[model samples]
Target: MALVNTKEMFKKAYEGGYAIGAFNVNNMEIIQGITEAAGELKAPVILQVSKGARAYANPTYLVKLVEAAVAQNPDIPITLHLDHGPSYEMCKACIDDGFTSVMFDGSSKPFEENVAEAAKVVEYAHKYNVTVEAELGTLGGVEDEVSVEADKAMYTDPEQVQDFVNQTGVDSLAIAIGTSHGAYKFKPGQDPKLRLDILEEVSKRLPGFPIVLHGASSVPQEFVNIINQYGGNMPNAIGIPESELRKAAKMAVCKINVDSDIRLAMTASIRKYFAEHPDHFDPRQYLAPARQAVKDMVAHKITEVMGCDGKA
Candidate 1:
């Protein structure tokens, strides 16, 4: 009926051995596609807004789009989340603007600084009943304003998780265990692997804690092929295997953030549509199919990858 925080969702996910899909939202079609699938399947979903998205779509428009989704899907629990908020000001703004959850990503900063900044955000967000998510290690690849070289990426140290959580008092912890951002996550002929061992250690150290995974999209080759087939140039864009993500869900991962897959699905669909109908100049004509493709992809993720189809 209204925007809900991730607290109860993550709690149920941890106990049920499933993960909730946190889909990125920028415009009306993306939000419509995500919430349509979620409402139809009765899955609780998180609609996250990145800093870049906020700038591109205008924060006010994004909020109105999310509120529209709330009105349209009264039976499903949906969350308006700030994804990868770069500073306390951004987090505070989102929390005050009606975001149910916010993520303060200080992974690139010094550990002590990260803890301090995240604690500051947590202290303020709690007063409004908003949940905070903080990151531990850096992830590689480009996504919006977040990027790190592969050489600079670090696996989350399980040893530091407890102290960081205790100091920051965060509701969720995002640890970089090997998943990278964007489409070109892996190179050709290389098997994508996740450091599940690190994840296991972190989960053991903080039992019953909710773990968040960023850049967890399982880039469907079918979408890549469709894009490539229609003149797109995304090559060797591999993602974490769904099997691996499912395993992590069974472990301790409660929230899995998926962005690139949504991009690929819509891009591939629009590309194929444009190629097929070169005469169509109507935006609605092409966007309808693109929106449907997004719906299909998200529905698949809800039922297959996220395992949260009926948990709403």
Candidate 2:
């Protein structure tokens, strides 16, 4: 009924061998679409807000939008999470602003510094019963304000996972295993692959600990084709394969962050709608189907990819 943290969701997912879909939300329609799907599927979901999202849609507006979603879907468990909170201050602000969970992404920093900063966030967040998530590896590509060059992207060092988890006391840990941040995850001719071997080693070290995958969105080719068919020119835009993500879900991955696929779905729908109705001027005309597109995409994820359907 109320906003719950990822603690219970991750626990159940770990035991059930499925992963919860963590959808990034920017507005009322997106929230409606994601939560509506969750309600129908009987799945626990996470609604995450990134730094850019807060900047675009005012933090208070996003929080109230999630509150409205909670009111609408009282039967489904939901978590309002701050994604990639870059600093202790940001994490503190989200915890103070009633976020059920917050991520302190200090992966780019030195290992010791990351642990120390994450520990500070965990200490502060736990005071308010808020759960904390931390990142260990630098992911390639860009999402919101976070970016890493492909050459610089690094897989999480399995050797340091135990030490980092022990030091930070984070509720969940996001590790990079070839999944990048944005839509252009792989080149046109390149084979997209995830380093599942690294994940296996991490699991061996941190048994039963909740693991998370950022940039897990499978850029649905149908959406890409629709967008390209209309007016968009996103060339060779690809993403992590759903098969790989599903495999990770059954592993130690308890949470999978999906952002770009939702964007693509909504954008493709709006583009196609306008292409068909050039005379339309109302935002609702296009946004309605865009909302439905989000719902459809999320449903596929819940039932097909994450396998979290009926796990609420």
Candidate 3:
């Protein structure tokens, strides 16, 4: 099947009480791993590219990689998306380059500025049959180029959701409800809590409109342990609990972004392989296991947190 926009995917997820996994992709192995897992699980998946990712892997290469994935996994639905597009030009570039969906993250801008810019992107994106996602409120932590201090993080105002959606004409809304942007979402002794109350209120206002959650990866302890054991020093790297993500899925959240988990899994596997076999120098030797780790992590997410295992 050809790549599709999030419109139909989100609709089905909303009605079926599940959320599609939006995994960030920056390389061939990561793309292959995520698509392979989604294909096996018969789940719809969204492969996203951030600005930093575009810089790391050229836009043309990223698009071609995703296209190859679609060709390889013809049975499952896949969407190519631009995650946290900083400007209309960026969103337009991705849409023109064959992205099925684009997210204009103007949350850091003033409310009016955000609405205007997002609306402009929506106008351009819809003309090309590409769906747009907009964010309201700010998330804490760092993901690629996105970074906000915890003190600056703010919960989305439920009342503003209706206006943003109406004015922007975005296909989905990503709201900040306590889920931060990166691996260190919380402190060592602090408890991680999502304001489901904010989600509830936003749902009531928008009714059936699709909602999205950024930084939704539940950083698996096993992967963290593996990385630490193999000469990595990531301390207190926590994430949203799976139970909370499942709860969000049962509500209006139709799309959840997961990036750190994939990175950790791949890094851990590569570190372990190199540590145990220092004699190997072939790139494929280490990448093979890293790819497998990505596949395993994505499969676990599909069946566990996303609840999108068999919903294709």
Model 1: pairs clashing at backbone N, Cα or C within 3 Å: none
Instruction: Return the lDDT, model 1, position 198.
Output: 97
TM of each candidate vs. truth: 0.98, 0.99, 0.99
**Candidate 2 residues 16-38, lDDT tens each?**
99999999999989999999999
> Can you write out model 3's per-residue Cα lDDT over 17-83, one digit (the tens) per residue?
9999999999999999999999999999999999999999999999999999999999999999999
Ranking by lDDT: 1, 3, 2
C-alpha local distance difference test of each model: 0.94, 0.93, 0.94
| Candidate 3 stretches greater than 4 Å from native | none
- The whole-model C-alpha lDDT of candidate 2 against the native structure comes to 0.93
Off by over 4 Å in 2: none
Worst 10 residues of 3 by lDDT: 184-193
Clashing pairs in 2: none
Candidate 2 to truth, TM:
0.99
